[model samples]
Target: MSTVHIVGAGIAGLAAATWLLAAGRRVAIHESAGHAGGRCRSFFDETLDRTIDNGNHLLLSGNVAMMDYLRRIGAEDQLTGPSRAAFPFVDLSDGSRWTVEPNAGPIPWWILLSGRRIPGTSVFDHFSALNLATANADATVVEAVGGEGPLFRRFWEPLAVAVLNTPAETGAATLLWRVVRETFGRGATACLPLIAREGLSQTFIEPALTYLEANGAKIAFNRRLRAIEREGDAVTALDFGDVDVSLDSTDSIILAVPPAAATSLLPGIEAPLESHAIVNAHFRLEGAPAAVIGGMPFLGLVGGVAQWLFVRGDIVSITVSAADALAEESTERIAELTWADVAVALDLPASPIPPCRVVKERRATFAQTPAAEMRRPGPRSPLGNLFLAGDWTNTGLPATIEGAIRSGEAAACAVAT
Candidate 1:
């Protein structure tokens, strides 16, 4: 039996191991962090006295890879969402509220209905998305879709930033169009928004670990890969700071670490070098449970520092994507600024802020711009026995759970062949 030495215990590595093990291959996972789930994990915050995810992510039903991974780990029921595709948004500047509700079929008849479309946007404005069909590699989100308009302000801009984690003015239009094609283009059934019912760890991590352990997969924490020893066209060994792992002819390697760490280990590897920041603020509601967003647990916000707000019980967590400037602010200041928006969006008093925990991920994701998209490498590497898996890899998708999981599956498939 050949043993596959997988580096990194994030979702990408876990997904790779899961697929390999299911194919009757031996697998071992090595992670630098003590725990799994990298940026998508949950932790107990003493300040809030609750378990909160390091980041907030929204998954659509169209994410087939993510759904398959969850099903493989027996966690298909761990997510919760509305029965229909409804995204409720609030404009803090004017206190106006609306919900973008797509119909059940592929035909977007919802756009014709004023109540289901973005407020003040004409039907022709909605059709402007067709402009992306002919967008070239150099086209940006603002270029493919008109930059200034009620539709751009209320729909395209927020969707681009949330999906790409970069400003829509320069973010790749092709990437955003790919997302639209997969989700919104498919129909309301595919665009249904879903979030972890309990926490990220419980839903995506713990169950995966359990499944892997039950199948005799080796999982080692704090075993960071510092260097790769190459002999001819194959990787001969992996060097950790304290130990080394020798690879035989049958043995293979899969690198599932971040782009920077992978670049450090394998110099000259093409990967997205630029990254953006994301700021997530979790606050514990004092008086009562958060007034849900149109009977949902999350709400989209515009004209505020925050972009998305998720309510889990008494905890209200807000996500600010492409928040390079906000990420530089002090935690106290971030909490204050986001809370003010949260107050208005949630219809709560703004004076005294509740117990809040601010988490700033400096390199949340690669800058999903036109140039950065060109830097993404595929699963197969120069070495015959080595492969790569991560959202940063060329999965033809943004750095999302679906993209990460798909990358891992692609690497595992490459290894099998």
Candidate 2:
């Protein structure tokens, strides 16, 4: 069996290795970081005396690839879901709430019937989104939903951020359309939203590693590939600092690091997209609400200090999606603004604000601008036995775990074939 060298032990790399190993290929994963789960890590906050994730991530029934990956790794049971076909939404401004039922299986019938919970939304909203199904493939989401009203702004804009990690104005319309069609428009089973009952590392990454190890896959921590040596069409070896690991001429390699690192390793590779930031604020509060926020685990904050709040026991975390605007702001300032938003949205009066942890990942995601769309590369590269895997690649979706998993699967399949 041919050996496969996977660079970066992120979710994508892990997924690829898992697949390749299952195919009876010898696999070795080299990671620069000492720990696994690159962006999806968690740590015990001693002050709070609880394990906290680096950030909050949600999975939708529409994310089939992710769900399948989870089940394969034996962590699918770690996810908790609300009753199928129901999503709750709360308006922090007025404390008014609504639930968007999943409707019937796969196809989103509720979208056509439920307008009261989704403020400013109407039956036309479904029609408008459906129209996008036939829109020009090259058009931006903003162009596809031209003049569709605040419903587009309220529901679509946040949805785009949650899906693509980019704003609707710059996000890919075709991707959004596909996401909606597959998850919301296809059937009711695709609409269930699953939240990680435990930390992401425990629920997804760790289980994946265990599965890989059980199958004889090796993961090398602190072994970063500084460069790739190629002979004509094939890669001969990878250069990690202080070591030169030779590879079989037929061995396959998957570069699953960030775009910045990819550009450096593959000098000729072009990444047209610039990186963006996401700011997440975690607060340790007393007496936090246990009831699921509206049926959805998360709520969109409009015209307020909190953009979106996720309630996890004593820890109340707020995520500011696509938060490039706050990149230059001080941590204190960002936390202050975010807490104020949470206060208003959660309707808390005079509650003591516990010590807050503000995480600002300046390069959390790639900027999904129009030009960036053109820069996204596919699984196959110019070099043979060398492929790319990451959410940043041309997975059609935004920089998400689902996209990462899909890209990894594609890369692994490419190598196997």
Candidate 3:
């Protein structure tokens, strides 16, 4: 009969509620936004006359936690990916194209095969990734992988930026290496590139809401957590602008909001404050862009303002991670520059940029620098009945869907015990 008052309706909160509700525990979700998914949701853009996600997100097959969450919501079939682990990349500066395909087994003998590896990279260069795996707390991606090399420029740097949302020169190496260990280290089976087949909301959010409601979980939108009243090491009440909900001794609370909101609500709590921005440009294309092997919907880009391209029907969306510099540019200018890269990568004409919608997620994620990584707090707080869950928590991984899901599960487990 214990009810859990969950704050926020993002993936973290939804994941937490889903787990608790499935256990026959009473659960309620409160969100400030009118809709769910926080930064991972999609909306209809009139300019493009199509639905587009606020940001482009991808998941590897190794994301076991997220896969399990999707299975719980009966959305396991809503994601699409390539049959194998292959990353097709194009260098706009020289028009050279290549796909880094890892072998089935873990040893990665594919590095010795010219046809399987990136051009100008040798086995010795491939082995340099070991530094990343063993990087210490103070080490950076550039420090672990070295500064100037074909492999570093073509592979490690982009992966670091995309995963960490921090510049390679200073991004924490441990995060990148953790990603490598979980996905690429497992084998080709675990590294298959996966993304939402329709949109992030449809695949990750809406279905979760549906499942939660069907299981007797109540969700309240626009009921933001204004404050938390504490009475001697326990959350006594939650203030939601117009009303305050008092909690009994057996009731528990899950703080699933962003780090800033958590810090504001709880005293003497430290969390990652430095954040990175991401820019996504969605263009209404005349037709689908060429796919990577096995009809993968996304392509990696180098030597351009954009980093990743996602093609859905007649829509082409560009994802620019670690986009602090680019996020400051005008929306029109970002569309123009991103179109140039998309045109080259997709082999399309560069004239008359199609109707484009630019989504700039300022503070998309915490800066994954060593200093910021040290600031991440764990789920347990001083209050006995309170627990925290978010990608920004000490999940021992970068801010990703997998990390967020894992964090929620961790909090739920902690609260249960």
Candidate 4:
């Protein structure tokens, strides 16, 4: 059997390896980094004396690809969140708090309920998002939603920025619409929030690596592909820094690196160039406050620097999506601003900030604009045996875990034939 060479052992590469391995194809994974889980891993923070994920990755029940991937690796139960589709939010502008809870059915009558909707939003305002579904290529979330009114400030704006990781003014409306169609449109059963109970590596990355290795797949760490040599319409060889690997006609190669790395390997690739940052402030606290609701442990915020706050035991983590400007600020300033939001949302006193670890993922995700989204290429390249896989690829979705997994599966399907 011809071995399938998978490059860049991130989630995309790992996912592709698993799919091919299940189909009885010989597999070999080569990673440039010394360790696995490129961006979605946990590390022990000495400052906080705890293990913290590099960034916050919240999953919804409607994320079918991620759920299927988790189940395949036998780690589906590793994630946990609130039992119901509930997202509690606080408006720092007016000191108003409310929980947006979706009902069991598709008809969103919950928005008509006073307490279930955003503080000042009406049912018509919630349903106004229907414009997003038919948004054209040039339409952004702002254009679709009008970028004003009570719903925009309280609900659409926050949800758009959080899920798209790009400002609503520039974020593609279709992408956000797809997310809403899958999650919110499907009702509460599909919109329940979820996150790794232990850590991301324990839930998503480590298990996939283990499953691939236990299935007799070969994995090589610290093996970076310096160049890929193509002859005519086929990729002939891959050159590592110290070693060169020649590919047989039957053998296939999957390049699952990031867009920047992939551009260097394959010349003139159509990949998303613009990227945004995601900033996280992980703070160590003594214990949970008395205001904790059913131990849900996370909250959404409006008119604040911190977009979302997540709590796990004694650690409280704050997430700011599309935070390119904030990422450039000093750590102390970021902590100070984030803690202010956390304090108000969690109902804690405005005490001095605790020991904090600020993490800035500069190239966390691609800027999901219509122009950038159009630049995303499919898995197949000019070289028949060489396939491309990444969240940045044309997966008909934003650069998300679900898109990454789907891209890998698409690459596997290409090589499987």
Candidate 5:
């Protein structure tokens, strides 16, 4: 069997390796870093004396690709969340709180109830979603939905920023609409939140590595691909910094690195160039499982610097998405600002922030503007035997775990043929 050479042992590469290996194809994964998981992993923070994920992510039941990937790697039981769809939100300005709880079925009858909707939002405000269906591909979230109303400020803006990882003013409306159609449109059953029970590496990465190794797959860490040696429409060899890997005629390659890395390896490839940043501040609090919001593990915040706050045990992680400007601030400043928001949301003391570590993922995700979205390429590369797999690729979704997994699967399918 021709071995499938996968570059970058991130989620995309790992996902592609698993699918191909299961199909009886020989697989070898090479990663530049000694570790896998790329952006979706956890690490110990000495300051906090606890393991903290680089960024907090909230997955929904409607994320079909991610769920399938987890099940395949036998990590389906590694997640925990509310029994139903309950999104707790707080307005920092007025100290108001509410939970957006969708009904069990696809019909969003819950929106009709004032208590279930966002505070100060009328029942007719929910009708703004209808505009999404008619939104053209070039429409931004602000343009698609009239950006003024209370519903847009309290609901759409936050949701768009979280989903697209870009300001709602420039976020691609089509991508946000697709997310809404998949999760919220399907109702509470599909929108049920699922977060890693332990951590990202434990739930998504380590299990996948175990499965791949158990199935006799080769995982080579610290083997960076310096260049791609091509021979007329086919990848002939891969040049690492110290060693060069010569590919056989029958063998195939899967390039699953980030867009910038991919472009360096295969020049002139169309990919999202502009990217946004995400700032996360993890604070270690005193009590075990310090707090909960509406029986959910995470809480959404409006009129604050922190967009979302996630609690796991005594550690609280505050996330600010599309935070390019915030990412530039000093770590101390970021921590202080985020901790203030956390204090208000969690009803903790305002003074003396807990032991905290601020993480800034500068290129966390590509800019999900309409123009950037249009630049995303498909799985098929110019080389006949080489395929591309990454969240940044044209997966018809934002750069997310679901999109990353789907892109890998798409690459695997393309390689198989």
Candidate 6:
């Protein structure tokens, strides 16, 4: 069996290791952090007496690779799906609210026929999407949605932020096509949202580690890889602090670290370096409503302080995507703004705001700019045995959990080949 050395214990690395182990290969994983799950980690909040994730991550039924990975690690049951394909969207300016539901068929004919969901939008509003869907795969999202329309501003813009983690003008059209074609285009129910009922560590990462351990895979924590040595087309060894760990010429290596870390290790290699930020605010409430705030797991915010809110028991967490403006805002200021929006939307009685926790990921994802899109590297690197795997890699999609899993699977396949 071939020995595979994977650097970075993030989702990508863990997925690759899991696949290799299942295939009866020798594997060793090195992570800089003490624990696994780089971005999708969770920890116990002693003060709140509950588990909290670093950030909220949602999955769609279209994410086959991610779902498959979960099953492989024996954590598929930890995910809960909403009853229907619906998302609540609220416009704070006018106190108007609407629920966008999936169409009866695979193609979302409701969005094209019904105007109630997307208020102030007409059937023509979705013409651009249809046109873009049939356009050349190399086209950009900006080129597709160039005209001014309410749908472009409210629907497409917010959707772009959620998917690409960037504005529609900068996001890639090809990637969006893959998302729409694979999900809504394939089947109406394929877009149903899946959320983790428990913490991410419990639902995804920890189980993967357990499976790896059971398969005799070695995992080293706080072992930061400093450099790589190559012989001909293969990577000869890896440098971590004072140790120079050697690898067989045929042994494969998957660099699953973040883009910045990857670039630092391989100075001359080209990889996208653009970054986007995500700001999340968590509020502990005394009591939540009997019926959940709308039937949807999350809601889109337009012209509101809160972009998306997740109601986990009494703790209400709000997420702000592509939060460049909120980068320098104080936690107290953000909490105040977000709570005001939440109170209005959820009809909360005036009460003293409970303790608040704020999380800011400055480099949460790569900027989905056209220039940045071109820089995303594929699984194969210039070095034959050294492969790349990460959401930031060229997975065709944006920096999401699904994209990360796809990249890992691609790298594993490359190693096997």
lDDT of all predictions, in order shown? 0.92, 0.79, 0.90, 0.89, 0.92, 0.82
List ranges where model 4 is wrong by over 4 Å.
Answer: none
Error of 6 at 304 (Å): 0.9
Arranged by lDDT, best first: 1, 5, 3, 4, 6, 2
Candidate 4 matches the true fold with a TM-score of: 0.98
> Which pairs clash inside model 1?
none
lDDT tens per residue, model 6, 8-41: 9899999899988888889999998999999988
Model 1 lDDT per residue over 1-417, tens place: 999999998899999999998999999999999999998999999998899999888999999999999999999999988897999999999988998887888789988887778888999998778988678888999999989988999999999999999999989999999999999889998999999999999999999999999999999998888889999989999998898999999999999999999998888889998999999999999756656567888899999899999988888989999999999899999999999999999889997999999999999999999999999999998899999999999999999999999999999999999
| Cα shift from native, residue 100, model 3 (Å) | 1.0
lDDT of 5 by residue, 257-326 (tens): 9999999899989989899999999988887555567567899999999999999998989999999999
> Candidate 1: lDDT over CA atoms?
0.92
Steric overlap count per candidate: 0, 14, 0, 0, 0, 0
Model 3 Cα lDDT, one tens digit per residue, 300-372: 8989999999888888999999999999999999999999999888778898999999999999999999988
Model 1 ranges with Cα > 4 A deviation:
287-290
**In terms of TM-score, how similar is model 5 to the real structure?**
0.99
Clashing pairs in 6: none
Task: Give, for candidate 3, the lowest lDDT window spanning 10 residues.
Answer: 287-296
